[model samples]
Target: MTESQDLDLTPRDADDVSVGRKRLRNWLIMGTFTAVIGFVLFQALTSAAQFYYNVDEAVARRGELEDSTFRIQGTVTSEQAPDANGALIFTIAYGGVDTAVRHVGAEPSDLFEIGIPVVSEGHWEGDVFQSRQLLVKHSESYEAENPDRVEYDLDDTPGYVPDNTVE
Candidate 1:
């Protein structure tokens, strides 16, 4: 009787094998789906990251930057008058190297004059950096205007106002 009881316990039914296979298949499906989702997320986040380079570095790495978005920091070395289509072409230089830039959107800010530092974000095309966005960096110093030096025109109607109030 003990032997008979042992045999009954040792033998597994077909139902048990079927249940085990189903559980393993379900777990494999879940794991595969999770891995695929994680891979896609990683790819998207890495592609969206933008790296910045100086003018000299950009010129040196022009081959790698082609068709890729990047940020460049430099000074406006030269500028050409706007074309009939309002496209502004200019050159920015840093570390003694220059990169040609073309902007087709709105004109640069008043502070975007020559020799001023600028950070441009765009992609590198053939022999040029096509920038869609331009940022001008200015000094952080602030100076208040003198209130004592007020100018009034005698020959014209006087409606002038000073910037600061004198104590």
Candidate 2:
């Protein structure tokens, strides 16, 4: 036979081609799935992470922080009644430095008051810190020891009388 006739020019078996195609397809699917999962985890972690700082440290780094969201811990040195828009304005102090905060959200619990420590979460706007959430810090032991102590203002509660008061 001639050399040209002896050469096997016909295509390879169907099974060989199909096996290569299936392997490539599986790899593509796995790669896409891994990429998607990685992206989702990155987003969740970044959004959940919150940097914490004291009032004095936050004030010192105000220029660097700018509009970034964070948490500040300090004692509530002063507080104002709800404003016209129902925002509670207060001042928190730490290490002898004070930062003003404008809280616009649900009213804080009875534990929130002047002289109490708190952690405010939000970003700084101009010279004041605009907060959406407030966390009050109180000792459970203190409450247990002073069960009779009135922590909240009585005048604010309309028609509510204290049973422990002397008639």
Candidate 3:
């Protein structure tokens, strides 16, 4: 056979080259898709995660955390009243440190009051925490430990007297 015939590429060689190109394209597409999915999941998880801190820690780290949203836990130490924009303003204390919070959005549950522990979620606005969500921390053990102390309206449960009621 001549040198030209010996070096000539066959139809089978062309088919193999086409198959190799297709495989590389598929791999590239799959890699791009996997990368995109990974990036989306990372962003979703990171954005949903929030750092929790006590009032004292939050106060101490105010400079570092001023721009980030986080959760602060403390006992309500002041009266809760509405501000000019109808936001509830109050003070919370933990570990002898106090921080003021201005809560906007939905009102907290009835359990929210002075002395109650609450976790507020928001970022700092100046020296005050601008909370968009407030969660009251309460114990379920109160009803279990003191069944008789549970207060019920006289109309709702007739003849059931609460422990605080005068005889």
Ranking by TM-score: 2, 3, 1
Q: Estimate each model's TM-score.
A: 0.54, 0.58, 0.57
lDDT of 3 at 68: 87
Better of 1 and 3 by lDDT: 3
| Candidate 1 C-alpha lDDT tens digits along 93-146 | 776667788887666789887666787888888878898888886767665777
Candidate 1 backbone collisions, by pair? none
Q: Write the per-residue lDDT of candidate 2 for residues 1-167, one digit (tens) a residue.
A: 69777897656665777879988999999999999999998887876565468888999999999998899887776678788999999887776677789999877789897677788889999889999999987755443557687765543322222332111
User: In model 3, which residue pairs have backbone atoms overlapping below 3 Å?
Assistant: none
lDDT of candidate model 1 versus the reference: 0.72
Task: Summarize candidate 3's per-residue lDDT along 1-167 as a digit string, tens digits.
Answer: 58766785656656878989989999999999999999998987886565478888998999998678899988776655586899998887777677789899888999987667788999998888999999998855464556667553332322221232211
Worst 10 residues of 3 by lDDT: 158-167
Which is the better candidate, 1 or 3, if ranked by TM-score? 3
Clashes of each: 0, 0, 0
User: Superposing every Cα of model 1 onto the true structure, what RMSD results?
Assistant: 13.4
User: How far is 148's C-alpha from truth in model 1 (Å)?
Assistant: 18
| Global lDDT of model 2 | 0.77
Tell me model 3's lDDT, rounded to 2 decimals: 0.77
